[model samples]
Target: MLIATTFSSIASAADETVTGIELSYDSWDYNTSTSSLEVFIDDDAVIVSLLAATSSSSTKKDVSASATWKSSNTSYVKVDKGVLTAVGKGTATISATYGGYTQNIKVTSDYVYDSVQILKNGSNAAESYDVSLGAEQVFTLSGIKSGASNENITTNATWTSSSSSVATVDDGTVTLVGVGTTTITAKYKGKSDTVKLVVTSPYKSLALSPKTLLEIDMGDDDQTIQAIATTTSGSTETVTAKATWTTSSAAVATVEDGVVTPVATGQTKITATYLGVSSTIDVVVRTPYQSIKLSPAKEYQMMLNSPGLQITAEVQELSGNDENVTTQAEWTSSNLLVATVTNGLVTPKAVGTTKITASIKGISRSIDITVFPSVTELTIDKESIDTFPEKSETLPKVSGNTFGGDTADVSKIVKWTVADEKIATIKDGKWTADAVGKTVVTAELNGLKATFELNVHLTPVKLVPSTKELSVVIGKDLALPTITVVNQDGSEEDVSSKATWKASSDNAIVVNGKVKGLEASKVTLTATYLNKTTTVKAYVEEEIEKLVAEPSSLELYPGKSKSVKVTGYYVSGKKVVLSSKMNWTVSSSTLATVNGSTVKALAVGSGKLTGSYQGKTLEIPITVSPKLKSLTLSDKSLKLSPGASYSLKLQANYTTGNPVDVTTSAAWVTNKASVATVSNGKIIALSKGSATIKATFDGKTVSMRVTVK
Candidate 1:
């Protein structure tokens, strides 16, 4: 009998289970209930035959897969009839069920390919291409794998054109049909690449419309032309700007971007050429005007009731032909009371200006005539004065011919006015500069105005600083607050240390560029310069009293040393290490000595080691043991034969009554080295004689006699 059982366990965040199936041929989690499959684009389909089984008699056997295949998100990964395919880069839940048994396999698809390169005309394309309109190129798509070989995926990729109207692509074939630009994209799974294409028409021949061009006006505006380009297929298009255009004579006319401009009155040919085909058009360049104008002397100045000056005028034709029509033209003045024009002569009757109109061939143009004063002259006490806005000066005491002719002050009659009120204000013969710049000031009298430019600038202003607050630790110096100086032109400058400083309370003080904390209180720190003052708050903290040198007592061996540490405790229960800054001293130099907080043992004695810092002192008792009270030889006398050697042994006895071997370290001497020589704790017998051996260590010595027989 065939039986079905379901068993599951919580795997990671969610519960995924496997039942009634044998899961093998995998590396991770498939047999345990939670399994997933990973694949990339263009990957082979995975056959799920492992999920199929059948029961017969007393055994289960592998059978054809009859289970239905379904996917959670078909866009990511999908399965059809037990075959799984990857569509895009994402995850999908693929489930299969048959005969009351179900199994799930999460499939993840990823885009693993790195890039795609295009192959044009059966070869790899190293760069983009430009094709003519109606041309075609067979483009095969290639998907390049990262760190691997390039793959020809033209048949497997989907091809698309960004601009369908300009070009079209089908199965990797690109066909250009219009004169435009477009990008061809090749996609394989989720990886895609694009190549830009520009389609241009094959130009054949260039032709100009009307076989002529109209003359251009003399201004910034340019006139355009019409150019038709004919192709070899007998098709014509207006490719005016696409063709290069040139004038036969630049002195007569110029052409640019299909625009032709007339430079002088003449006839010239404009030629436009494209792709080795050229066409020419004859253009007449001329100006269009109504009548004549007088040159050189547009305006004439004449005294009242006097003969005027004679002027000349020139008339041009539609063909740009000029003629002197000065004597043939009739003239008249707009203001007859001020001036009169007879033929080309203008006579002034008053101190004013008149418009003189000249007519030729019934076409009219005007000129100007002015009359000056005969003897009047204007003078001023000051022509131009350099002053600021704070000072007020009267309008120039302008007097006209003060002694010789028409002697009278004309300052009031002048009526001065400034051109720009925002720059300077003028009222009742007085002016002020509102802004820093040069302004035009005019003095007018009897329709005559004289203009003068006045320059004004702002006065320099003092510096101002932004406010700041500071907090300092007890017995510490802190940097002063930043100060900025307000410049004359209303700008700022950093002058933190340049300003004079003062404190409101004695609890804190300012010195150099820093503020010193005195007592635990608040004080006002002020910075002043050039009548400007700015204040800031200074907060000072109190001193801490918790200084501790641990292990109030210590024991050390003779000639041995230890490092002493000193730490300060704050009110907030914080510790500050001060070993390097404290002064370390021992009561007796014979017992111990300290160098940089390290106490060295000198003798077997007790002494007081003191550490002093900032009005506080610390004392600790230090004792040195094993002081080497005496050094003695184990054998005081020895008898040896000639050529016999004996090793010496020495011992040091300390004040603590401890004995130690001082053999190799003890200083040894032999009074008669010929009899017995002591070297490195060993004595050698040389000849038959008596010798004395001595050993010394730690200010103690011992002697022994050796006899060689």
Candidate 2:
């Protein structure tokens, strides 16, 4: 019989009775009292556990084998015997019933494939892939599920690339487009994955020989260049024959393959491109010469019908080497009538100066050529000379006159001889008088001759003074008359040094070729040379009665100076300058300092200077003004071009005076002579730069900035 009995007879068995069902999962939190659970799934399936809680025991018993599990939606989640599997991406309820108790668990299913992976080559997983430029790569996509084998989803997935220019992907195939980085992605059923892709160029950099600049001479042989590229693997390869070559200007230079040929004298750019990398070099096609020079660097002299002079031309190459091009140079003459040149050979035709030039290519050098006519006449500077015995005299200089009216000194070239050796002897253009006799000398040059007469042991017959009468001021000296002697040969000789002098009056005396006046009186002086004698009269002037200074007054700034003039008036209405003979005195030494007749203002003050000559005195009033108040320039700043000149006016102002123009007198200086040069307040711009010009006058200085453009 089926009978229900509420019996507490088995108390021990009742204490172990199941009270509620508990659900747990390693990835989710389950509540025993709440009777529900929620779980997040990253994989397709997971193991779930069920437990039974006893009323009298704290420990729970595993009831997974005894529990029955059910899924709300078969497409979202499915469960069987405490095991749950995710079918799709959605949320579903999983329930377990044990011991008459049921627990509902919420399960959110992700994509059936937990992750998408990219496989390279043959099933090898890769996070990043590298492909060559203009190349292709095949990538495979796979689905990954937890606790399950990975599945190939390459065909069923949508493939995309981050940058199509760098890489393009279709299905599982990836094509490299450029040399950059891009991301490759595959998406399937809400599951997406990515892989970094780098499409690289085979070459890292391209380099060309003569990397900086290539210089070639026009009409010279072509230059061969080599192009090399560095690979991504840190290896070098030669690509000279494979590089595409181009030039900026074909007229200047042209390149084919790796050969560079100069076309004209100009500049161009040569570029070499290999794959996606390029390199360029500047090319210059110009003359190979730096400068040209000609032998016989200075002016040359030649005569008509003379042998032609061969001039040599030297060209300084760009490599700092010199080359001789005498025969290759083209020679020209400015005046063909004077001289003619052919291949650096100069031939004179007439007597004149001509400019001769030797040129090679475009460089040239010039020299002046002077053609002279044949010498026709010869002469000496002195034809006759009188001297005593045992005295030596240098022979006269010899001169040659050309037929073309040109004169030249031919002293060293002329041949000189003496006719009478006993009377005189000649050697090295010098003549020695040996005896009391006369001799004849001859000089010859270029078929022309000249004669020089020499007289020895000549006696003086009479003495004549240069002056017969003279006047001397009192307490002053006058130069004595120059004494001359008439020789026996009728030649005059100056014997002032050997003559004896005497004064007739005691008031005037001769000393050191000068006549000194001690008193105011007329005196007579005599000079004798050997047996000849001469006389002269000297008159002394009286003392002055009054003295006067020129200018009378002075106005000067400190550090400035002026000169004073003193004139004495005699009793006979005669006046003489006594500036040097006067005794000077200043009223204030602190205000001014006097040096002879010049007075320099020392400080700002007023003073008077006195000059006493004999018994007469002159006074000059001087006022030393303050230092220069200011200095102003017409332009404080200037802007000018090269080779431009501008006149600047500098005006100086003082404490008590009119403005003075110090443009021409001020001291001028330029800080930068290369940029601008200043002289006397005039500025000249030299080049493009800046400079400062300063002007100083009367202890004051002012400056102006200049810009040369």
Candidate 3:
């Protein structure tokens, strides 16, 4: 029975003990679970032992008494214990094992019990702020929120600012510093937000009035110019700055920043600009001038043909700011009569006084100029009353001539002095004859003197032949007579040395002062002195005489012969042989022969007769006539047979001045009709008949008979 009872007990325990539980959770909540389990217990309040069960193992779970479980109202729950405690979540099984017969229960947990809340440092807050220069600004972040939590809430958040100096935010805190705008950004949990901060200043800004400037000046290291520029607003904010520069006109001036440099002595415009505005200042450039002083400051003098004089001036340095300065020197003369300047060289043109000026830059300084005249000197060779001709006399004659001295470049008064009174006397620069001798004359002019010797000789009187009696042939020689002279003492003197002979006719006549050649029909020989000349007449007859024959004698024969006769003459009327006796000759002997003045002919030929006289000769020709003879034939009579013919030829001897005509013909009365006739001295016989053939020449006739038998 105990074994039966234990077995029965086992079966009952299985049916009553806890098995498994199911759960429905809306959220984690303990009150809903407790509430739902209470309803199944039939008591609102019960002490239940909740046992949790899993598929692997089982155990009785415990819960606090103060825990509450809640769920949806329609959900069911079973309790395995008398007391029910709410647990947070899930499903479980419960059972009671007091009696041997156990009872089982099921429990389910379906509920949500967690809550979320948000907190803030302040309700209304600012994220950014603005501050003035040198002033500080601060800002605090607010309006923080939480989704759900009963645990500690600690997380890393980030904040960033756009301009650090102007305004900045750190860990939701912001600080403002300098000017400009600032942006603050807060980042958390991959989300970000931004805020802006602006800073400004009450003070005005400063800047250079003109942003850029250009300055210009002449090319000088010391050249300076001023430039000005203005600012918009400020007391100490007005700032000035120089511009770094280069030069396009370096040959004139160079400018660097605000400084200027002059390269040469010239004018140039310098432009100085500053900022965006500019004002220009003019810089004047000056070159040092040179001062000059002329040498020989009082007067200058020179002489003609003298060496050139140099006029110079000393140049002094002047004080000034200058560049590339130079000086040129020059000179001038007021009048060339006193002096002249050629490239500063002076020469005298004449005797005078004038002013010489030295000039520079249109300003002139003057100096006096003076010139002295040259001295004059005169002298005569002789001083006395002399006899006649003097060496210093240009046209000395027997009466009395003065001797004048040569004067050149003489201007001062001259005084005359005679060394010897016997030969010549001097008045001015002239001398008068005193005696027949030589003397010296002197003249003085302003301490300068000169002397000359004078010579006086006796006058010579001349006599010459008269030209009216002179005569000469075209080509011949004649002797001229010498001119005779007499002195003042009436005594004859040899004047040939002092006399000059000339011919007053054609140049064909030549005279050598003493002798002359007769060259024309008439010529006059003249003897000349210093002022007088005498002519002499002379005659020259032709030396060669002409002779001519009144009628030349000539002879000739009837054939040809010549005879020539000539005559000649001489100045002495002497007999001369005739030209026929000198060169007369016969040309041909066949035509003619000549013997002295006679000519004879041996045959019928031409002859030439020639005669010579002086340098000329003459020729004569003669012709001779031929002897005549009557016409004749070889036979006087010609016989011809019947039916035969004959020819007759005739010849004649005739003399005529020219060729003559001769003709012949037959003159016969023949009974036979067959007989022939003759013509022009030719005969032809024909048939049987007798005829007469006759020839006539120049009206003369001759006859011959011809017969044909």
Candidate 4:
């Protein structure tokens, strides 16, 4: 067998230099030639070295060919190529010279009487040895009483095997060669010992299982291949996990340990090697296996009355495989109420969501489903449900008919939404009343919305009188208190109709939403709502003894304003400002106007500003004066030639106002048209003559003379 050989260390040596020569080996060196290189007979071989130039840190070099060797006492020791050999037991000196530099090595070969013994180690005794097959054995030999101290001699003990074909020994290490018998011996100084030995083979051939393999599809699970090794002694062992595995074509298949994975569509060989024996199997990786998928794998949606859609499943078959088997695929629905699938036809029903599944041959796929409602008609029997606070009741029924004429009772199925959950809530046709107030209750079914109002009547926790005081003109009625019904949760609601009202004195007044002014006497008004009562005070004013406009008199200019106040004197001698409460008007709107208590002057005229309440009326004397002093024409005279025209304008100069344009308001005329004609401040010339043009504004006139060109 061709054994692959592999070819470390500690040291104790001091370097010595002499003249220009350096001794490289510290184990054997000398100061001078007389004691230069020293070594023992049959000692571990050591090399004598000489270097002209070197450092201890330099890499050690064996330049035996470069140096000449010399030896003293050639019979006892010899030097050849710087290597000293002991031929007899004696002392000798060895030396080497290179490049004009020389170093010496002294040798001491001992001649001592010694016996040898055989052992597993401690060389010098064992020259040849045997080892059992399938194992490595170490042999040893020693010289008895050989040195001056009479110790075992181990150095320079040569080792060999009698039959190298059966066993081999290097130094003292022995390796078994075959299963056979042999003899081993150890010798030293004409003394020797022999031992009979035998070696056995522990391993033989390795075999792989599934000697022939079928083609495997790509993506197939990894497969394990078994390995078994047999010994020459007829014993077998499993080494699958320990055996090294390889694939001829890793692109087609790959093997790790004993597991094989098909990679691509090709053929490859798998080999398992154990104990130097290899076994192989063929592996073919074919295309992947066939599969199936639904057309809409993600999700599908359908609406009521929408055109029917066909659900399909396609089989992605392998080469030479069967065609699509959509017709044979089984169909199922997660919700029949939401949608239905029959013979691949998906018919949407009421609104909801569901999952549709398809199965064929052992493969299956599913689609997420959503069905929206299509309502043809929605109906609820009631507009509102009535319940007291903190009460419960069954909600009214609701029904929905789809466009497909399918009717469903949605009273319990519909989702209920409430504007105020504190007021009322509905769940599965059950209503829970929480507080007082009316809230809209909406029901949603089949995508259509329907609503039934919820009225949670306030349980009379307390009543609040919204009206505190009332002032009414004599013989005039006043609005009554708007009683607020408070619920148990400190909530208030206007429930005026929920309570009956009785006046303390019907002769004095009556209360409902209002109290009528029946008499001038004091009266008590009471309001009740939801069986809760609250009271308010009311006093009708006595008939007015006199009525007057405050400030007694007034004066204003045209197009000016004045704020007025009206006061009424009662029979009790009290005065009240009735300007806002009384109906206000002006005697002549053309002159002035009064809205509430404010008066506007329309022109330079006077009108009575009046205030009235409860059939009593009062008026104020007012006066308005014009602000203008005179009216004048812009041009005193307009001269024109016959066949020419001229225009004249009028202006009003005021006492307190800025000059105002009166041209548009002035009346224009010509006294003699033969000379010139004036119309609307424009003069047209006909014949040559003089004429007088008159402009009038607000009963005042200005004249101008004109001549035609």
Candidate 5:
């Protein structure tokens, strides 16, 4: 027989737990003295257990018993009695048997249970979290449990990074590093849970919109380009861009920083590149050509024989693009035989239409020019003289003619004819005149006839006398010659009325017609008619005569009152008059006294007496001798001195009827200072000696010395 209890020995336990059982204790205790068993189970399962007791008298009694489980199953189990016991002091087991089978269970009272739980604070169970790369994520762990109160439980949780480049986790917190997928593990007490953390890069995908080419103008640099970029992963990204420019023809076109320029007169292409992608652009860089234009752009006209004309041309426009410009321009004319051009200057050589053209940069323009015949006219004025003497009295008309034409040969012939044959005549446009009169004249030039009046004037004719030939003493009238004009019918005509007369010298003469002034002299006369002038000479002569004083005879006595008379003569047919007062003088004051034309002797001396009448005067000598006291005669009374001789000189006073004779005597002597001696009323001196002589007259003797040596 066996008794069964629902307990097992708690001393033995495996290192690892089995599927559904936990060991309550590692050791068990039993008291033999009280015949009781102590049971210890895991602390979580330490409640009562079902066991069956059986008494056994012998070692093998029937011990099939049934026991009811308390904390486990409600079913009863039969155990053999040998299964209910404790192997150690702190272990217990129960076994029970109902039929032939028995089962044993172990329970421990000294077992302790410890556990920990991890949870996110204030979060749902299955929610996901997000964080940027190089950023942080936090989580909290809670809900931990231990088997008993006041039990010492130790726990440590570590965070592990699945990918260091992507993310890392520590103490249930996670941090993102880069752009990739990673896991964050939370571990505690040899338990771990992993959370997936993906770290994405901040890079964006770039794309250029509108993949077509563009066109830009040459030399235009003011332009900008825009494009769009997108990220593959629904994230924001940053993109950078740049551009490069190129040209197809470097010489013709050049580009810098997406700008293109044209260098010559040609076309070229330019392209622009942006970022890592490239685009093509069509650009035309063209140079322009220049064209010339003529002002007056149509036609010009001038006379055939006109003065030189002027023409000009100018540059109008330049063709092509940016590089087209005119460098130089020139001008020329077509049909140089009719016209010529030099440096935009045009000249016509004949009467025709000529084209003048200007050229610049392979472009040209032309102008038409025409020349025509010229006309001239002639003007004539009445015939007249331009110059005439101021002294001319007769009227002299003047006239002229004017001629103008393209040729000087138009004035080949000119003819003139006068009407009055005697006054004036014309031949071959020349005129001649003989007298003072008005004459009609006609002039013909190249068969064109014209008429004029010519005036012919007579020159004044008169007798002209020198101023020296005119006399105030002569009471005579002077006459001047008269001038006459002949008429066309051969008749004499008085021309004095038409003449102008004037004295060539002033104060010389005055005249009226054929009459002369009181003072006579030559004069000039001038006459003019029909623009013609002439001159004539005139003369006047007169004579004058008068009585003048002269010495006919006169006598004076020495040392005595004696007088002499003077007389004047007047010629026939002469005008003469005597002055009221006569002029008289004596050569010696002591010898004579003159009153009027008479002289008186004062002393015994010889002197001359002079008298004047009108513009004439005369002088005469008078003899003055010494007074005789008595007469004495001598033998040499008639003797003469050597180298000296005396001739008989007889004197008679007409009023007194006295005759006197003088002679030199031989006894009379004459000194060298005395010239001769006298005897018988004459004395003589021999050999320049002096001698005494006597002159007897009226019983008075006069003695004088005559010396001769």
Candidate 6:
């Protein structure tokens, strides 16, 4: 078998001068004197490499892509850039030349099969296979040879099916034609193999019904359980009679062919098994009802001609479980003139007393109810009032008038709500305005509603500043102006701390009426309160000549990061750090990435970091090196089977930040290339032996022991 075939790394030559060359496959040297190239027919394509040795070094280099390749007999074998493929069973000569040097190797291609076998799903050896209805199964034909490698001949073999009506075979691919058993045969060269195949439902699992816990009342009819067999094709069939049914306790329940009969008042488990799949359910048998009781055991008082209340009837079962039988029970009222009841719903018709009864399964329960007269009209003290934001006031007093000409306070009992919460809020008889808006406050009681219009007014006509002009030096704190909001109703309010402040330029910053000078320039400041804005002129006085960045240069390893600080020097000997106000960028994104003033090195290269402040730009040269603090392999040791390959990852940890993946860039070497060879961190096991793999990068070295068997 061939393993680890990746062609992305091929078709490339080194920049070194070639002096001599040799051909190899899987790190195994090919000899043209005595050994001949042996290849199996219809096997995986093998890659041959041309290793060149330069005059300046003793080590051999890969020059396969730069070499010219040919096969003497194209019918026997085909060579494409050192990749050899067997087309027919014959002998051929493979030759490669590079830099006036040529090498030739003899190749022999044939199917040396000692035995033929059938594989299921490309791997496991099987004597029989199953194909679901409306589905297909692909069988692999493996030609195993003694003292030689095995090859897959699925496409090269001739396929035949014993029953064409049940299943059809085409190149080891068995297609289901009907539901029956068929024999599949594969003929490759002079060897043949056969495997039994069944085309049917291909049952996957068994589901039993009913799925819930079976509850049977004493003296009730017998219940039947069902078993459903689901196939792999998502088709289901009833197999209750075909399944094996058993009961856990025969004293409580007896089950025969999915039919269960309760024998006593107890619980038992019922199980059904079909086609190697089984499902179970709990069976419960007991006396259903012991006694029934109404939800409200005492008398209930309600208002007359109001909304009705639903009374539930709960029954205590013999199994110690409660069941709500409100709809199932029969409900009635003792006095129809006072109240009426239907389906456990009781409604009061008059101001009198009545008894409500609910009966279920010959068990009865009763509750006494008293109805009171409802209110006629609801009234409040005041209709509406005005308020402002952040102001609270007490709500109006409410009274309910009854038919008997009596009145009572209903302020606390009434439900209050505001139409718009953005305007105000009323809770516990206290109203507080949140913003300047108009909304209605509604109070509801006894099916009567009372609404009042509330208008929150805070309209500001003009904004006035305490100061008209201001001046401050760079790196100094600027004095902010106090603002006052003048309302339209001839009223004024100071809003210095509650206004949105902004500056027209980067020379100064204003937050909540606090200002700080950033550069030597003049800017306009504005303060806004309730949509009324006022302006003020501010001057940031400073004589700045140039800008400078600390640590004129930067040197960091890959994956390392740091921040650059920018400062401005004034001609008056005043210096200030303006890192946040400076716009930063990098010359090459492939070398480093800049976020604000922070710079992170990405790869090994040289670039320039530029920062522009107040029209003055400064460049800081940056150098990224591949100097690693430590290097290690992901696996300390590895064990692999013959003809198997594994990719090893090398982590290069730097002095700062996280490690980087340098697997493909590191130099890989193996002590025994014949046993195991490594290319760009991928190790391929050629034969059963041991080898040591080493990786070197950035003056750091790490090794791993590999045992292939």
Model number with the top TM-score: 4
Q: Which lDDT tens digits does candidate 6 get at residues 454-546?
A: 878686789999766665557766558788888877899888887888899987987545688888687899887666799987767674577
Error of 3 at 218 (Å): 66
Which of 3 and 5 is the better model by lDDT? 3
User: Model 4 over residues 444-561: C-alpha lDDT tens digits?
Assistant: 7546788888877756688877655555555666666566777786887776666566667754556445567776656667676544677766667776777777677668778778
Clashing pairs in 2: none
Pick the winner on TM-score between candidates 2 and 4.
4
Residue 256 miss distance in model 5 (angstroms): 36
Candidate 4 colliding pairs, count: 15
Report the C-alpha lDDT of model 1 over 1-709, residue by residue, as the tens digit.
1122333331322133223443222343132332466667676665554343333223433322655568999988877765777887788887765545566767777665777777876676745677886456788888777788888889988999989977889988887756678898888767777788877768666777766556554332556778888887999888787778898898878999778876765778888875446788887765454457786445554545346777778888777888887887778888998887787777777767788887754356787777654436665565555544555666667655523355555564466888888778887558876776677878766554566677664443654544355556678887776888775767676777668899998888778888898897878888876457778776676444666986677688877888888887767777678676566779998988888778889888788999875447889998877756777788989999999999988999877787899898878899998898997679999999899999888778899999999
TM-score-superior candidate, 4 or 5: 4
Off by over 4 Å in 5: 1-442, 446-478, 481-499, 503-512, 515-709
lDDT of each: 0.71, 0.80, 0.47, 0.68, 0.44, 0.80
lDDT of 3 by residue, 1-709 (tens): 0000111222223234333332222232224535433221222333443232323335433322322333232224433324443343454554444323233334554322122112124322345455555454433333233553333121334567777866666655555545688777655433345556666654444222232332323222453333333334433422223532444456656666546665644455455433223333333343334544666665554434346666665544455332221124446677875677664556767767767666543224566766545433343333332347543442111111112332233212345666787666655345577577767655554455666555566676555432223334345444444545665567765555667777666633654543444453445667765345777655433333554543344344455434444545556565444544334556775766666566676666566666553334567766655544455554677776665555455555555434333334423233334575654444456666677765555345566666777
Q: Estimate each model's TM-score.
A: 0.23, 0.25, 0.21, 0.29, 0.17, 0.28
lDDT of 2 by residue, 1-709 (tens): 1111121212223446666667767634343454333333434357777877767667777778877788888787778887776666777888887666777767666665778888887576577777676466888988898999999989989999999977788988987766789998888866888889777789889998988799887557899888999987889999999888999999888899989988767889999987557799999888778988888998776656568999999998988999999998878999999999988889999878899998765567899998766678888888788777788877888777876688876675567788999998887568888888888999975567999888775677888887566657688777787888888789988888878899998998789888889998878888876546788867677867778888899897888988888887887899888665566778988888887788898888898988765446778888988767899999999999999999999999876566888899899999999999998988999999999999999788999999999
Tell how far residue 404 is off in model 6, in angstroms: 41
Question: 3 or 6, which is superior by TM-score?
Answer: 6
Model 4 gets an lDDT of 0.68
Candidate 5: TM-score? 0.17
Q: Provide backbone clash counts, one per model.
A: 3, 0, 76, 15, 126, 0
Give the candidates in order of TM-score, highest first: 4, 6, 2, 1, 3, 5
Better of 1 and 2 by lDDT: 2
Candidate 1: list runs displaced more than 4 Å: 1-38, 42-45, 50-75, 91-93, 104-106, 119-131, 134-140, 162-165, 168-173, 204-709
Q: What is the lDDT of residue 402 in candidate 5?
A: 28
Alpha-carbon error at 104 in model 5, in Å? 99
Off by over 4 Å in 3: 1-421, 438-455, 459-479, 544-709
